[model samples]
Target: MKILYAKDFNRVLDFLTINLDGVTLAFSTAENDRSFNRHKDYGINNLNSIVKDFNINNIKYLNQIHSDEVLVYRNDFENITDKEGDALITSEKECAIGVFTADCVPIIIVDDKNKVIAAIHSGWKGTYNSIVTRTLEKMIDEFNIDIVNTKIFIGPHIRQCCYEVSEDLKEKFIDKTNIDRDILFKGRNLSLEECILKDVREFGIKEDNIYSLDLCTHCEEDIKLFSYRKSVGTYGRLFSFAFIK
Candidate 1:
């Protein structure tokens, strides 16, 4: 669970292989987008081109709805009619999987031995709905993943420094999660990273195994990381993905 900056994108493969023998996970920044069609960039043609870079046999994806729903990826999960979920998972070898997010948290979990991986898109709504918790539960139930042995990584997004909220939202989060209301601020600022970390821990992931990128997209506009709050109507998006080798 190493937090590598985009400066080291060239070394991404190296890091993935060194960290785990059978799997790899990564989060892309705005730099990956050439034309920058945030919604359509991850379309079929684009996904196919991206898949060629890796030796993965198949790539599973989700129509993320920013809800607490966690969908397991198997023939059955794929065959379902209405495709709507916030997370995706796969145990197939060389099976790459992905989930897209702009400023929302990208939650990744990998089981080195079982060769299972999961990717989750957790926005503030998804966070309050406990999407991370549901994703972990789905992993444990569907794949029998060992919570203790699994590795989890939370990618960069809106940090509290820039994620100011209204009092209504703050109180709602506190009531829903029952987190220490003190963590919410007088200015109604909340740390999405901290909230995700707390949820990951509550899901039985160890503190040491949970790594996070404190990069605040709003604060670092120069990096071109998308910030819904910062960019308003001009914001673009990034994708975070994980796969079993």
Candidate 2:
């Protein structure tokens, strides 16, 4: 974890970032007192500070709706506000694509071989509906990205340890995925990371290329992140992004 001080906002920006093959990947962590977000409904307002601190430019992002929608950027960064999607993909250089999340999963897929990258917001709904699956498929088909050459970074989110859900909801996921109910449930808690991994492997991505962090927004004692459940809808959001610059 690294800290970036945004003097303008007086924010102690704690975040993690890594660069691989010209693409930069990052996510913001917050103390319980404040949020990293600023937008109201749908826009890049929330990403302004985070992007600036990272020195990222030509930003492209989405007004995530927790759906399976995936957008392929085509110089339409101007119309991002109208785009209601959970994932954004592009091969454009000097532009960063991103998504916002609290307890939901933030995923960044990088295909350096083909110069394609994706930023995905996968909440329970998006996970159940296979948002990442759709995004990967789009990248493979449209961008001609080779799955084997791609590396995935799973950012901070509510892990099974803190992501307790209704038994009915757990059963619902089992019914939808046909995945062993026992494998997904840890005494009424769910592992979104597991769900995401199943889809990643099914797409032929090797485990060695997939990197996931164990940080949980709800229960992370160190480098705490904003949690929707923990804050009861008053929580701030984390911004996850990736791009070639």
User: Considering every candidate listed, which one attains the maximal TM-score?
Assistant: 2
Top-lDDT structure, candidate number: 2
The ten-residue window of minimal lDDT in model 2 covers: 1-10
Q: Give a tens-digit lDDT track for model 1, residues 1-245.
A: 35655554443421222246666776666654432232474455555555776755666676777788777777545553247888887787666667766678887888887878888888998888778888888888889998888888787688777777888898888777776776754367787766777778878887778776656767775455666777686666666777766
Taking every candidate in turn, the Cα RMSD to the unseen true structure, in Å, is 3.2, 4.9
lDDT of each prediction vs. the true structure?
0.70, 0.80
Candidate 2 on 150-218: residue-level lDDT in tens? 888888899999889997898898888877777888888998988898898888888788888778899
Lowest-sum lDDT 10-residue window in model 1: 10-19
Model 1 pairs in collision: 57-94
